[model samples]
Target: MTVSSDRSPVTDAGAPLDGFAVEGSEGSAAADIAIRQLRMLGAASPGPDVAVRGAGRARARAEAGSAGSLVLAADHARVACALDWAGPLALPLEDEPGVQAACGLMHVHGRSSGGPRPLAIDYASAVGGVLSAQGLLAALIGRLRGGAAELVRTSVAQAALISVGQYLAAATASGDERDAPAAPGGPPFTSADGVPFEIETFEAERWERFWSLLGADRAALARGWQPFQHRYAAAVCPLPPELHATAAARVFREAAGAAQAAGISIVRVHGAAGERRRSDAAEPPPWRLTGGSSDTPGPPPAPCRPGAGLPLDGLVVVESTRRVQGPLAGHLLRLLGAEVLRIEPPGGDPLRWVPPTVGTCSARFLALNRGKHVVEADLKTPEGRRQVRELTAGADVFLHNWAPGKAAVFGLDSADLFAVRPGLVYAHASGWGDARQAGAAMGGAEPLGTDFLVQAHSGLGGLVRPRGEEPAPSLMTLTDVLGGLLSAQGVLAGLLARCRGAGGIRVDSALYDGAALLTAAAPSGGARRPRWGPLHPPLRTGDGYLALGPHARSSPDRVARALGADRPAADAAAAVARLCRGDRAADVAERLRGAGLSATPVCTDLADLAADPRIAGALDTGGAAFVRSPWEFTS
Candidate 1:
């Protein structure tokens, strides 16, 4: 394979690298993104001697890498083929309008009775490819350092997990309640004069301050809407007539302004009629490597035989992370055959008490943190600090998601740790990229790196909004999941450098960078706004909902036949809708499959997901039925 030595920044006008062709088909957009990232990191040449293959075959190659050169693979359908056990589902390569409709992101809509319409952009596949590429890069780095070649895998289904992880976490907690708690009706509201704006006051103090600023009656607050759960439930359920009237009175820009003055978060909702310019300038590169030199050389480590264990066997990681992102990275590392010891505060991670508890563990905590060792430490104390330093002395990787500078306060920053472990791979996951960016975004105040705030700040809420309606944040914490995966990728890349006898390396990933990548990857122009279109959106069958692709065939009659209806071409949609309305969604789906047309039931709840035979084997029944990591080692 021919490898290019041109190490230059990739731009929109950059030429494609040679010898990096995806095997067995035309290169997919997801592959293109992954290849670009890998090339940028100098892990692989534009023409690396690699062949991308199917997940099943790729798994075998990765397993064999335990005794040989590292094998890196990216399967576009890894999740569907491996995790869901759905065979050979081909996804669109480009970010088309209806791509998300296939996944159910399009089902999220304004409070209207209209048919399901496509969301503006496709995010899952692109993110999946990018993350998969990062994973492969990490493996490649490991291989170069005398480590055995490893297999790196990523799939669209795995990427789609981010869009629903929060919901899945909630589902694991509540058993039957698959939905997360609503955080009040904070969407954009129209003023009496017709100007539109949005406001948020999820915190109790912020809500009280907002009420005080609005001069609302204390009696209104006394009606027992103080707790967030009550407010969240109120937001999801229809408001009573009196409550509606009261809420309707405050739908004005002035109310939003007052709320903002009281330290609440608020913004004017932008329209799709005009091009939306990005508020911040283009962000810096998503990944950075530090403390590695090309001139250094060291004896390669011994290669191990395949099938001994996961690819990361014999690796040691020290993690000081909590909540979703950092813990998630550590979780993946643990699954990949690394020994991860999670260090929690003396009082334990705050997530331990986040409700929907099974005995003492929260569902969120359990879902993100499985198969890892844990310990308690008080970083404020010298002994705790000494303990951490000792742990780092023997660790290959040190991972953390603390607020920017919190590590420095505890003397656990890269500089401090490198003194003890010069060859350590330091990975830092954050809500924002670095202190400068965080300061600029928060006006010099300490920023809370929560997923929701990052979503709003990154303009994702506006991008997903229906036309002429208030922007809504996704119920899923897309950034947190993606950030976690990317952070893991960074750690792997650092490890690769260390294998090359490079000194201590620091890798940085953040929610802001993930969001920016999603935004940047979105197709420019030609986006179909959400609306009821023929062959688009889910159709209501009598017993349930079904999403069918209109572009899958040349004739609408074929669609009618797929739905088991014999009707004229002109009336095909109506006939199919009528026929499906009378039949069970499963039966209709089976019949459509028999006819070779693409179709799927609109899964409305976690129970529906759990009922699937493919998913049944992966559910954890120890407490609530939580989903196991959607990956397996063939070896």
Candidate 2:
């Protein structure tokens, strides 16, 4: 096994580090193993550029002293450790196109051995996207002092979270007991704004808010409305616009300031994109990849075990993108270890103040703009565009959601940027592709709008077909995840080409594209799976959903028997519903799924399952909630 190492020395004498194989060629290990010899200079400002070193070299280094050693290996998508990491180091995920999850190496000196054991920090939450060496090293150091080797997991919608919750619950409880809510590492069923209600101080001759709103209504006062309100109810109180925005912008800050003065952890959480680093320290020097050559890494872990390989690393991405599509690409790329910077137009990305929501943010924006750096630069302006042009020059990858015509106006249509930013990997994410956006050969921006229409046009609704008695299929958040993956995948593949001097731009991700991708799943062996579903054939799992196979290539009787009654009748739905109502959802799900037949009650929200302690116990890492990143970086 070969691994990559950061700028530190090789602790052991196994073999000198080597690079990865190029994308198109293989079989020549000699060229693949050529290490980049350097005159050793200061770190670059562009950020650390990671490359693979044969795993043999990694083993040699891990054997050396347990400090100043940073190991970063690209497994194609998720990075892995060659050996246990043990020192102050900043391990950023590679900024390549396909990478999905980056890892921070954490080494806690073992208490008995008087040395630190390995630990890792997966910063998918509140990610600032600036993986500076100091910042990275600092986080690793903090973890060693007390941080657990956390497992950063990812789940799509409540479905993914529910399965995880059930697993944790089963792992924690003893015989017969089905419920446990206080389990450590479980998510709060409802984590409300912690502090209760507050009185807003007005600039005019005004009294406190609660005193004014309910003081006159003693009836309301009885319900704590006037004063003793359920702190939550008071907090949720709707205020007049003038007073609300004013107090919110200033009053909360003032109150929080006071609390902090008195030693409290009081802070407002902005959207992930707008979130700031815990420390102001400038982005650290980029890692110097002075050793090793080549680009493409090894194979990735199958979906069954995501730990096998990392798809992305050390790829530079500038997303001059917006709305859901562009930001979403940046978000997913961050997971894959891509260095993604979301360059916003002046006054920030239009998303900064879109959807006309409360509190200077949009709910949709918050969810989509995570894991990337948000910077204000108006591309519409000549100067702004020039600045962006400069930024993109060094960027190995670029993505945008603008229509081709409009993007072309700003020098981003197709491979135009490649002229200025040579050998760059580029992609465009759009709701409507050039075909749909065209109007009598006037195919452009004016015609494209509304994600809903995109959904409808792509036959997303048709994909649902119809069941016996259920309503039509609904719009799903999964579209965003899938679309985002498409765009990132394009960029990743482009980087792989560029790494070998074969770079070029490509296009991927459309609302229609996502719909088509889903539609493709309907077929197998070039024949479509019959839409015949009593919703889902009378089976153990019930309506609209069916069980998956054992992968063993044979029908195992053990699975059939464990599924209990194989025949699914109308009565079975009632039975499952009945069990769920009695809090037996966990037990029944486990027992049935244990049989290797796909089973689990459709969870409306992950909240309930997250609260179950049995589920929480299985996740005792830094995953504040039971939901976590799918890959664990164990080299």
Candidate 3:
């Protein structure tokens, strides 16, 4: 089904931002688009529509009138300076190699046997855009509550870092090592008919049952399960070769039949043509905000002010979510000063013991769950649902990531919750929004909407790899990270609507929409595969590799000269590789940076990133290591 233009049901209700101006170079378009999308959702307070202008500092300053405007910038120093003049808000959108490397995203994305290569898509830049929008909403919320202006800052590098926070935590944790080498291996396992597809199952019994039906050896099935399960955290799956051979022995139809019989989910990779067909349809908005059952704003909020606290300070959030997307959303809200109370099943979440622990809990799980409270309850039971409703009664927000209809089955849906807590911001961080209807057009039996599966279905798997490489998901949990950010963005929008005299709001954010955003923002294939060569390509050095940022790619001649090569822009990549073959990656990167280019060593080791001084402030390495919040708020 094609996406509809009816995004936010409350768009016509209010427009708080009378003057919103974005200032920066052409590179700031990603961030600009994010702000505009939020405005489209009616996230602003009651006023005229958001006012957008050109790149000049003077132009932005002049346009931002006394109504308290928000100014976003691409330069960090420029934003810091703007805070003094632009009273309402000042946000920095920076995407540079130094931050990306420090954040360890470069390491995670490029992890493979063939040496580290840059992610084909502009992850840092795209995610930075989403973050910038969130920052604006948060700053606006602060202003509305405290009646004072604030400074909010984030960079592409920080966004990239948060995306890989789980992986970095696992790498630095104690006990058994959970990750395998970055060797080239993992899913989209090919069938005898040459069709590449991915399979997913959260239950080991189902995994065993599916492989057994496909005639895979008992030993292979048992051996492959760990790596397959580890794939999400490790960012690579080194499955036993026997399993690959097993899948290769059967046609796609036969393997699919086996999956159906076993009650597991399977989906073939969406090729370029199929992706083009899907892309032809209108992409869904980042989020959909609908009013709740109540027409009133519910209980009057307690008197609170931003003062010296975060934007969401004094708010309570009840979160019932498993896995990365939901937990990350709650985590982001907590960073914005909300008190998030996590609802886990009885005996706590099983993943808390997945290994590589800090103290008694898994560091990987803690990466996205630090600084949150937990409650034990089983939604399968009536009493458990009652307990959740009781918690939601006093909370400002209720967030969850249950299956499509699971919440309603337990009577914990938006309507049900709104009955108990009128103005609650109910957010469903789903895997796929209306997947059944949408999947019908995509031609499939409706696969489970997991991170890798969404990546494959959205054509991101094909786009993220180098041009000639095989198409497969990055295993970096790309969709989950961005989806989490989108979920938080939706929740903030809901809160903004409620603050503006609108009733309780219901927000729907999905991995599908997040993937659509990433794919839509990506450059066309031709532009990505430029005449000068691959955009932001990684160059191999004597000992390791160095990744060139977009800035460096733009000045190929400078790069060639720094590497002691003389060649036209088209051959600069080859020339640099040849000349830098005997130089250390760090040395080569330093030389390029000295030439006023953007380049950095591809941080293959998480430990190296922890040691990198440039982004030391972004990491909390005491005990359980994890990335800190990307945003730095100041009043």
Which candidate should be chosen as best, given TM-score against the real structure? Answer: 3
TM agreement with the true structure for every prediction? 0.76, 0.45, 0.87
Candidate 1 lDDT over residue span 284-386, tens digit each: 3456655654333222222434444445777789999976789888987876678898888898887776666656777667777767788888888999999
**Cα-based lDDT for every prediction:** 0.55, 0.34, 0.71
Clash number by candidate, in order: 8, 58, 6
Cα lDDT for residue 506, candidate 1? 76
Minimum summed lDDT over a 10-residue window in model 1 is located at: 79-88
Give the runs in model 1 whose Cα sits over 4 Å from its true position.
Answer: 1-29, 43-120, 138-154, 161-166, 172-203, 216-261, 267-284, 294-307, 438-447, 465-470, 525-535, 550-558, 561-576, 633-635
Candidate 3 off by > 4 Å: 1-3, 9-25, 43-102, 112-114, 174-183, 273-283, 292-294, 442-445, 525-537, 551-558, 566-572
TM-score of model 1 (CA atoms): 0.76
Per-residue lDDT of 1-635 in model 3, one digit per residue for the tens?
Answer: 12365544454344323234343333353454465555555434222333333224533542343212235322211121021111211211123444455356767766643445566666776776777678767766665565343456565666777888898888877656545464656787899999889999988999999999989999989988987888888887778888999999999999988988998888777654236444454445677777743356796334356364677888899999988999999999999888999999999998998877888889889998989999998889989999999999999999999988888899999999988988888999987788676568446666777998887766777777656667787878999998999999889887766665667888888997777777766655212321236435567779877667667677667778877765565676566667777889778877876887766666777866666665576788866568887776654
Between candidates 1 and 3, the lDDT winner: 3
Model 1 pairs whose backbones collide: 69-149, 70-149, 70-150, 141-496, 145-499, 146-301, 541-581, 542-581
- How do these models rank on TM-score, best leading? 3, 1, 2
